[model samples]
Target chain A: MIDLLEHYAVAIMAILLGVVLAMFLVLIFFAILNRLWHNRGISRKREASESIQPLIYSYLDGSINRSDFAARLKNKHDITATWESIEIMIDNLSGEERKKLQMLLDLPPIKKHFLRKLNSRKPISLAQACVYFSKKTLTDKSIAVRLSVLQEHSYNVIAYAATLALVNTTNQGFRDMALLRFLLRKNNASMAVSDIIFKYYDISDDKEVAAEKLEFFVMNPDIPDKTRAAVIRMFPELGFYQTADTLRDLLQINVKNDPTGELTAALLGVLIDFSDQKLREIVEKHRLWESPSREVRLKVPGVYADIYGEETTRILLGLAHDPELEVRMAAQRQLLKHRPLISESRFEPDISTEWRAMKKSGDADVSNG
Target chain B: MSQKVLIIDDDPAVSNFIKYRLSKKSYQVKHVDNGIEGLDAIRDFEPDLVILDMMMPGVDGREVAEQVREHGLIDPNRIIVLSGKKMTDEIKALFDIGIHDYIQKPFSIDLLLLRIERALASLKSR
Candidate 1:
């Protein structure tokens, strides 16, 4: 019985030893796989560096143009790898090697490409992109980068980028609606389409072309009312002088007719752009100053005052004593622009208290009117 | 002689109305929906006059008018174009293509009758 028990114990010991050896083998296999994976990753990175190595060498040897370097770099494959490799090469270059690179960059294409990359890639910020693109010193890459930035997600960045693109286009001696449409569709951002339109009136050198494009915008009902109003304001740039009547028609028919407060203000801005003395009299005669819609009275009327100064001043003075606090406040604010040497203390009314009183009076005035 | 007229228009309502009014006025008329059929009907019927609608689903009225003028079977002077939309720069191209007269859409039936009468009377005089 003791001998049988000893044989069974020996068999169990052998089985346990075999299990331990299998476990050790599996661990070793896994460790080898993990090491192979790590080495593969390192090799891939090295291969990428080697692929970009000649471009870096060419840059250091002064054999390639800057523009050519930039165009190749801009191609988007292994950019980070190539950039890092180039940096290492630049650092390792001796004084003579560095001077060769400097001389190579002086080549036209080299200078153009390097400057373009500097403008396009140097600053990551949208605002920086806009400013860099707007600079006269920038190469064409600046304009190209600016266009991409105009389609940026940030509103302010888009606005700045759009403005830079527009100014650049204008500097290139072309005026067209294509740029406007491009920016609007891509950015979905507008500080004021109308504001840009208004600026075109004075800035566009060709009257016929400016008129033709402006007419197309006004006729196209697809554009928003604010943009249409801005386009109407630019009619004066068409040099027809007959645009005043067309503007008046648009203001009366397109804006005031719809009863949209924002559009009314936009039309009023168009009227201000007209700057005709006769229209000022019409405002005075109609007693538009007393209208209850603060938009019409305050907003629209203020724009009128800005253009027809003395008459607007008289109209605003009457509103300064208006029963509606909003009307009074708006009138006061409009008056402030015309007031010279005016301090903040000269016109700081108790806004909180006045706001309540104005609300009460505004309701009362609406009922009475 | 029954002075036959063919109306080529995409809108059924317009074609029917014109056909009904002209037939009531005692003129024989045939109507077709598209420009191709309108041209074929003109060739078959040899109508004294053809009233063509400018905008159509296929082979627009302007192209039909050009084809008719090209065939020389129908006199260019006898064709009148009726368009529902406003006159645009494209109308100049129509004029160059031999469309004699154009009447904008939502036109009064009375105005159309007058135009037809004037055109027929001028043809008689010629």
Candidate 2:
């Protein structure tokens, strides 16, 4: 029995060793193949770029006509390279040159090439095709339908790219459907979601219509608090000041009821940009400085300062004593800026010492000037 | 003699396109990729106008502009900045340092050409 067990153990060890050896060899083989593939790709891209650039420039300068340029760009191996070159030109050039390039993208061969890529099973190829389409204003309903399907792709990147492409379409129904799907996606990274929403606004021909669509998302209670907050935050930057009144009302409501504090904080942040006497009254009525949410209270100093200007000295001084470190720091930093208006004698001893120390450290001077 | 224009931009696509356009327009153009090389080109090439890209890897356009202004390598008014950055206080400060003009990127090439012509014409007048 002992001899039989020993033989079995030795056989198992040999098999395990063979498996490990096979894996190592496979790894080595793949590494070499990957390096060769990468080098070849780089060389091919370089050659394509060198050959295609002059043709593009010539086309731009009117030396080559559109048909001739499209014909030259038809090299199957260099299609990606040609598209990339055209993409760069489309991004950088405007006026007649840009129009010509945009028209070139619709030429039969180029459109067919991208259309074929759109049907690719590979995620990277599909995503690239989607991105290429996003840069163009699509009139093709069939392409939009393909993009609509891809927007639901399990891969988040391909889905996001497809959604962006759909948003670029002139079809309002397609654009709305794509955006609604994108906003409803639970797995989206916050920054990517923000960017896509911004892109939706960017590509919209009618700013007012876009604002109304954004307002719907902002006002919809079923939409995630994060998305609403992002939309609210973008309003000031996008110059949707007309939404300010609605935002103020939302802030009042959220101040009373928002559980997460994120939405309330975002409202406060945007309102600071559009702050006025009415916003100031709202701030005072809520006494937002003493809000239960620390995030909301943190925004109080900026809103107070903007609405009250030099008169914010007292509130800044009061907030300088807040329980939260960040809130106190924010208030103190603002206080330092208003140092000229502050009466040092009114400061309590501990606060006085801290203020003097902050001054001596050059923080005050930096803020004051 | 044709006017000399030096382009300091990292993007070959942009620099090459500009070079081709300017060369066709009869301007002697030289292209360099980064700020350090750009500074050297400023001295070596002594271009009548410098088309500088604001953002680059090492030694950015602002520093190059500052050095040129400090050393009087070229007239501060001869520098035109190409930036994708929106107009901010920082960009406004570039004008205070005497940059000739700021053209936002994704800019019309024709608009850029027009600006270049006007800048050079104004220089000739001065």
Candidate 3:
């Protein structure tokens, strides 16, 4: 019995030792693979960037002909890394240079490669593909498949990126609405989409689609009030003076809907860029200083400050003694800034001298505005 | 001789794009990356036109303009302003000193070229 037990113990111990050795070997093999895989990715990206930079610069320098450039792009493999390199290269460019660079993406094989990767299981691939699309203009038909997934995609960031790409791709009114429709669904990211639309007014990578298209959306009583308000609020910052009259109309409608008048106030702030006169006219139209919303009332001083005249000064002075302390202080500040030392200074040569001196000698630190 | 143009911008991409576009029209374009280098290039290149970018680190675009005006290196008519942002009230002052045109950044190369042609033509028309 003792001899049998000793043999059994030896067998069990050997089995245990063998299992430990096997695990150790497996772990080491994987560690080597992980390192090698990581190194390969890094090397591939580095090689891709190194290879693509020269062709881009050469093209930008007018050295390489377009046909040769297109041919070179077609022959280059590993387009995922190639897309990344192209994205970084063209991120800051616009105009003819940007268009030329973006044209490389229109090449058949590469566009097919990226479009195919839109369904990629890898999140990184999906995100990168969307970014390239974001920068490159896409035909409506090209983006229709991507648009379907935008509303249903489980991945919010990828969806947002894709939505931006769709918006960037086309300026057609129906297409924009389609993009907006997918964006506005009762998804968790609706508010986020609203913020994105407000902030990135021109990421369209193209010029405005006609102010009327946006104006029509804002005018449609069927759309959500918040969306219309955001649209009007964005008009001033968009540098689309074409929408100035549209904004004035929207401002009237917004104040009527939300007595708090926050949207009206915000639009009035940027409307100064289009017309100080128009801004003043809107303010006088609404009698905004008397509006119940303190935010709207506070905007009055800034608008008043924009128009220089005794009438504007008198209006500001009236507010300087108004009931709301914040409104009073803002008005006082505007009045102080425009105070003329000489009665005739508005037309005086000395006043002109001062204005010129101030305009010429900017804040010492700034290079551009 | 090719028409001489100097482009002073902090962004190499922009400068190179301008250079490439203008070179096609046979303008001899030289680019400098910053304010100091821009100042030096103006004197050295004696360009027929200077495309000045606003928003450089030190010796900023305005400062470069001021120094150029002070030195009489090139007339204000020879200068065309480019800005990454809106030309603020202060930067607009450069217009009075002879900035022939203002082209906002991210502008179309077509627009920049058009403005360049206009600026040069203004000099010719005078």
- Supply DockQ values for each candidate: 0.00, 0.63, 0.25
Q: What's the lDDT for residue A292 in model 1? A: 51
Query: What are the per-residue Cα lDDT tens digits for candidate 3 across A1-369?
Result: 999999999999999999999999999999999999999878876776566656666776678876666666633344554565556447545666777878877777778887777878788778767766777776756465665565356787777677667666555553475555643543434455554564245554445654455666667666555455556665665656777777777677677677556566667766765664666776777677778887777778888655687767656666665788788767766765676632434534754454344334433313453
Task: Tell me the tens digit of each residue's lDDT in model 1 across A1-369.
Answer: 999999999999999999999999999999999999999877776666556556655554356755666566443334544544433333223345444443443445433443455345333444443443333223354455445445443564555444554544554333353345533443223444544554455456775666666665665556665555545544544444656665565555553344455555555655665665565654555466665556667654455454534455556666767777677777666555555532324333654344346456655665787
> Pick by lDDT: which candidate is best?
2
Clash count of each predicted structure:
4, 0, 3
Itemize residue pairs with steric clashes in candidate 1: A66-A110, A67-A109, A67-A110, A67-A113
Chain B alone, TM-score, model 2: 0.97
For candidate 1, give the lDDT: 0.60
Tens-digit lDDT string for candidate 2 (B4-100): 9999998888789999999999999999999999999999998999999998998998889899989989998999999876767758888888999
Candidate 3 CAPRI grade? acceptable
Clashes of 3: 3
Give each candidate's fraction of reference contacts reproduced. Answer: 0.00, 0.58, 0.29
Q: Model 3, B116: alpha-carbon shift in Å?
A: 10
